[model samples]
Target: MEVIAIQKSAFDGMKNELKELLEMTEKVTRKYTPIFKAEKWLDNQEVCLMMNITKRTLQTYKDKGLLPYSKLNRKNYYKLTDVQALLEAGQPYNTDGNGFTDQ
Candidate 1:
């Protein structure tokens, strides 16, 4: 049964402060948020299938630094963007219908 009241001017100021705080919070979150979620990732099998190459070829790409990837728990993962870049750069794979790729 508390009848205490805050002044309208005071309440307005508090509301404005809350709004500012929320805006700042949003800005901070947006700035620090990791972009990994927005990006697409592929595994070794998927990359091999997409590029029509073998696993050895994919490993060669990794060894030659033709593609960028992330390794987790002893498994290799690749970014879709990097794979696309490799495809766009040139034909790094064998065009002679071989099962391997160019070193």
Candidate 2:
């Protein structure tokens, strides 16, 4: 019984130490990885191609706040995940019977 108690305490200590080590490793990995490395960036052309729409239509999406974007210098950039989420939700914005819509 006494040996069992000793073994249990030792096991608990090892588990706690292991948890700490894993957490530290995660922190170090995150610290060295570039945040943008995880996100795939899409420019106007790529976004249009991916959505099978025109540049003007892409602008409509931005105007409607359906997609989030960032401007780097003179060019606009968007995240692949954001666009993919909208696609997964069904149709983008309706263009009516025409190929475009008046925003």
Candidate 2: clashing pairs of residues = none
Worst 10 residues of 1 by lDDT: 94-103
Native-to-model Cα distance after best TM-score fit, residue 22 in candidate 1, in Å: 28
Q: Alpha-carbon error at 29 in model 1, in Å?
A: 16
- Window of ten residues with lowest summed lDDT in model 2: 94-103
Backbone clash count for every predicted candidate, in the order shown: 0, 0
Please give the RMSD to the true structure for each candidate, in Å: 9.2, 12.9
Predict model 2's lDDT versus the native. Answer: 0.83
Give lDDT tens digits, candidate 1, residues 1-103.
8798999999999999999999999997797456557788899999988887778878788988889999867998898999999888875767345664444
Local error of candidate 1 at residue 28 (angstroms): 19
